[model samples]
Target: MDVPHPFDEAVATVKALAPAVRSESVPVDDCLGRILATEAVARIDVPPFDRAMMDGFALRVDGELEEGITFSVTGTLAAGDAPTGSPPAGSAVRIMTGAPMPADTNAVARFEWCEESTSSQHGTTAASASVRLLRSVRAGESVQPRGQDGGAGTVVLGHGVRLAGAHLSLLRTYGIAHLSVAKRPTCSIIVTGSELCRDTEALLAPGQIYGANDAYLSGALTTDGIAVTECSYVEDSRDAIRTALVKAVASSDFVILTGGVSAGDYDYVPRVIADLGGQIAVRRVLMRPGSPLVAATVEGAVVFALSGNPAAGFVQFETLVRPVLRQAMGWHDEPFPASGRLLHTVKQKPVRHTRILRGAARIEGGVVVVDTEMAQAAGQISSFASANCLVRLDEPHVEAGTVLPLRFLDGALSSR
Candidate 1:
């Protein structure tokens, strides 16, 4: 069967493969950054009861208080205390923030507006003292009612939502101890090339170069929440390549081998994968710098073979591998549509595929602006180092002032 375009086909393949990672019930604290597989319904109201909005007197006002009035202090209510009965007539309850409001109380008089007897207005203080109201409050004023955030059975977290710190706080408020999150997938990567060396500390031979693809891929995988169990390096020999590929596949849900996807004399990844009972799903892509990108499926897992060149593999990872990996983790959010205006000029000859140029994205006024002058070459590591985003250009030459969508990598455009 014919494969669809790389960008689309890769995603479709992932989605059509095994079902969304199995849902594992885990302690809420352990599920940070994991994809939520089920809707988190509140077993009870978020606050569970009407709570005080501030540390002040909670008064039951049937109608707007036309004038300030002093009231007897009925009792003090702390955060964990249950609601007391209705306040004594002409009396008020001193409540703290997160404390349950007294029954029949409609509003709280903040301390700033309340003049009380005694040096301090303590909630646990005796009722002998009184609070003088500086201003009149209407019914329900300053009172947080039950179910203000959501009532019982309301969905606080929808399915497929990525969990974060704030989300955890909300769930914890409802006493949710465990969550059903998508199971994390295991991944392994292979770095292939005779010219590559693992130890940066050692002196290099004339033809030797420090391999960076492994580090780059590992960082990206970790950031996306995929745990890499094995990261191995192999020479360009077919035997070495085949051995690493077979072992990586045996233990990981996904395998990534950098190098050998191209047609160069030493590029043997494609043939090795085919010989090892794998089918090449995509040999080329509609993208610049990473056009030689290759994807395949074996036994039921996915394999990505990227260009041996550093910059080329980097682009492929950003443009293609990330989205596929996210999808495999059960997240459906697309990653390539974010946009920013060009802050500088970038010129390039037209090509059959899209191009990704590295740069920094900054917010000017209200819109996002991308600067791309330093990202003209693929092999320059400094370009990727200083860049916070990548500008995707489909046109032959993008002018200086054109507005284009950008793929932000360094959280530079998050605030924008």
Candidate 2:
């Protein structure tokens, strides 16, 4: 059967994979990097009331230009302390930073601009009662007014927002001990091939290769916060593949199988998954390198069978599986391959979608230029290892200035 275009199949499968689980309440401390399920409304105004922004005296400011203007020091106000009535007219309060502004006080003057004296020093024996303003104070200067940051009932964080470190801090400031966030998805990876073995020390025969897909796949999934609960390498046998699939589906929300989905006679992933009552979503795509990609649902768990070649498997995972996994983890933005102009000529046939090799890139004169590291091939893992971005070459080989979509291995992409 002719395969569908890579972009078409990938987009279709992602849209079909519905979210299996949903949001849960987690402590604010653990909510960082998770998606918020509901808007977090501020229960109380930030600062709660008008408070001082500096260690100064709270006084009613009027036109005062004299070098030394004496005022009676009525009482002291510290942060969290109750006001001792509004500073009586013509009298100022000794207020510390963060202290609530007295009922009638309108401004604060820094200590450097103020001088103090005691009546006792002048006439002998009485409480200190004098303060002088060496500089005038302005209304609302150095004061954080009530609800300045956020008023009560204001939405500090909107629904569908991804929580970051700053969001956690904000939650703490708002006294939110717990918040609703989406649950993370769990995955299981199965690596199969009779020639593939996990033991690196074991000497490979003429047709054998050490298993690298399992390690790479597990690492990629874990980096995105998806837990890989089961990882196993099995010989290329129908029974072995079926057993592994059943086990993986039972234990994980998603199963990612690397190898054994191609058209070769020995490829057993597709047949075994179907025999075990799994529904094949798509068997192949019309893209180079990763054309044999397959996705299915075995006993309700999604299974992604990728190419045996490292490069092909990685591309398939990024294009097909990454989106579903990220969505399950509450990520709003689906991963899309970035677009950039090729720095050099990349030759490819116009018959199929092409994924070319590329290294790091930089913006020069407002254009993203990708440096081609090596030729494009499905089995060339070396180029993929050294590549930071996949310079996409669509059908019809174009010149150096042609804009093509680029996929960054690190999940970042150039703007198209």
Candidate 3:
């Protein structure tokens, strides 16, 4: 019997076989959640020019401004108004937030910090207005310098960066109307089991259960922005699995099959892949709950055969499948594993295989604490409801207070 591939070796194989990065031009409005294929260079400076940072009076101060210094109001500047003329010395311009700073003016005093006064002739307003300084002002105060956000020709966003809402807004600030992003990958999912039923609304026959693999796999891929081209629930027949594989490989960049990879009487996925001229890259992995994982390449499309058990499939998908898909889409910066100390001792039958179990991780008193008290069964999915991470236990007998590696799930990395 051949030895099962080590977990790390299997993951490395999958990554090495990932498809090369491909790029496509997309509008900036549609770039959210897309990975950048190339570095985003700024064509123009953000903010473009120096402007007022708040609603204030733009001042031309020759030296330190002291309280009670008066100045004549020359003009009013609102946002989008160009500076047509400079305010002479000892003069000020009433400026609104985001308005271009007038020529020769180096500082702005907020309206609340200045006292406006105008002379009245026979109860009528005078043509000239003046303001009294309530506080001191200096150069660069309340002034937003040009290119403060980003300078022209600067690489604002690096390659392989995943665009978020804030990233899109920043690109818009630099007048970036279009973006070069990695081409989105397509996926096809096949769930094989003669006893699997699709509809929960209808009464199930004997020895049949409603299928959750399809829903979980499809939803997970969709949530990550991968397009699921096909989803099939086939019975445990060799012909049915073969037919599904042929169609899936034809249309998708990758194919995912849950069930029929283990040494069962009805396990036909691995054989079917071989029959279709596909080469198996990884026959199995040395990991608990998902040791029967298999990776194959067929007709330029990679296939991942996983165990049908909900928790097992979920672990394999998160640990191996997701990372490869990310690489194919040009995301190179894999998240570093989070480190935390185990809160209690955990003992299991001595085995060399790695045990990946659902766990909850939290920071208490400036220290990371990991708790793996939930049910760690291959078939169970209930424990995932409260699990925030997956704890990797390499040894069967683990001592308490030992630091363990954790991988965040459900976007926990964002918060961490």
Candidate 4:
């Protein structure tokens, strides 16, 4: 077996091998959660015309606001109605929210502050009524000026932003019907183990365990907006593994294989990858739970072989595979670790390798506190029940109240 590379060096190698980002034009309706490949600049000013911000009366104000000022209501305007000739002096237009303001209107008085009079005896009918302002008004009140939200040529959303629901609304307001976004990476999963069963409904035979890594990895990648092309289950036989690898590499940009990377009689993943013309860049890493990780490139597809251990595979995917995938999608920023104080002492024999422990993190008095009481075995997945973070430790044992580096599992801070 070859000497394992340092954890940081191994991660760097895998990330550096990521495929280049590609872009495609997609309708804005389907762009949620996709990274923008180009800046979304407004083609036209939002609120193309001066608009009403509330249900009110549009009036032409020349000077100081006067109390009890009466104006003849010339016409009623609703949203989407084209502006007619501006009302004569001392006349106003009844407008609804979102209606375009008349060219001559300078101010709006909300209905709450104005009283309407339709007395025919005063030479005024309902069609042409009088409105009296009960309170003083200010110029531009209840009006949305043209380009108030955004002006033409303004960069509403910069490149590399992950589109969300709110972003879609903003884009539509600027008449952006489509957007250039990073293409989602295609991936495949190859699970190899003779003792693994893929069916969840069938009863497990003696000495056989249900395969879980496949479902976990597939769901995680899908949630991250990746296209999982295929998921294959193969035995430890070299022939089966090779055939699966060939198909996966041919069809997907990324292939993730669980099990069969370590030095064992049944471990044929690395050997088969090499036989299939793969250039191995990373053989192993100096990290606990996921030290036997391997990265290679075969026919332009990056392959990752992670430990079969459930906990180990989960840790490797979150720490290593996820970053490379994000980079391939044009997201260059990394998730920064948060400083967390240990709430309980963690007792474990120290090894030369860096240990990553499952933890439950919470905010206490504005400080991040983590609990590492869950099972930390490589094969056990019970830790996932409450573990939201992975605590990084260099020392053998840590005492309570010691501050350590913690990485949130979802890449965002969601403390209990």
- In order of listing, the candidates' clash counts read 1, 3, 0, 0
Candidate RMSDs in order: 3.3, 3.9, 2.6, 2.5
Candidate 3, overall lDDT?
0.88
What TM-scores do the predictions have?
0.89, 0.88, 0.94, 0.94
The digit string of per-residue lDDT tens for model 4 on 336-375 reads 3476999998877868888889998888888889889888
- List runs of model 1 lying over 4 Å from the truth: 1-19, 68-70, 111-134, 333-335, 414-416
lDDT of 4 at 267: 96
Q: What is the lDDT of residue 383 in candidate 1?
A: 81
Give the whole-model CA lDDT for all candidates, comma-separated.
Answer: 0.81, 0.77, 0.88, 0.89
In model 4, the Cα lDDT at residue 38 comes to 95
Tell me the lDDT of model 1 at 110. 86
Backbone clash tally (model 2): 3
Tens digits of lDDT, candidate 3, 1-416? 45799888888888887999999999999999999999899989877999999898999766769989999988889998989988888889999999999999989999899999875454564533899999999878899889988899999899889999999988988888899999989999999999999999989999999999989888878877899999999999999999999999999999999999999899999999999999888888998989998898999998999999989999999888888988899976342357788988999998868889788888777787888999998877998998988888889988989998888886453224
The TM-score of predicted model 3 comes to: 0.94
lDDT by residue (325-404, candidate 2, tens digit) is 77776675444556777777666666766454555665777877777757466767777655677665656666777777
**Candidate 3, position 100, lDDT:** 96
**Order of candidate numbers by TM-score, starting with the best:** 4, 3, 1, 2
Candidate 4 versus truth, CA RMSD in Å, comes to: 2.5
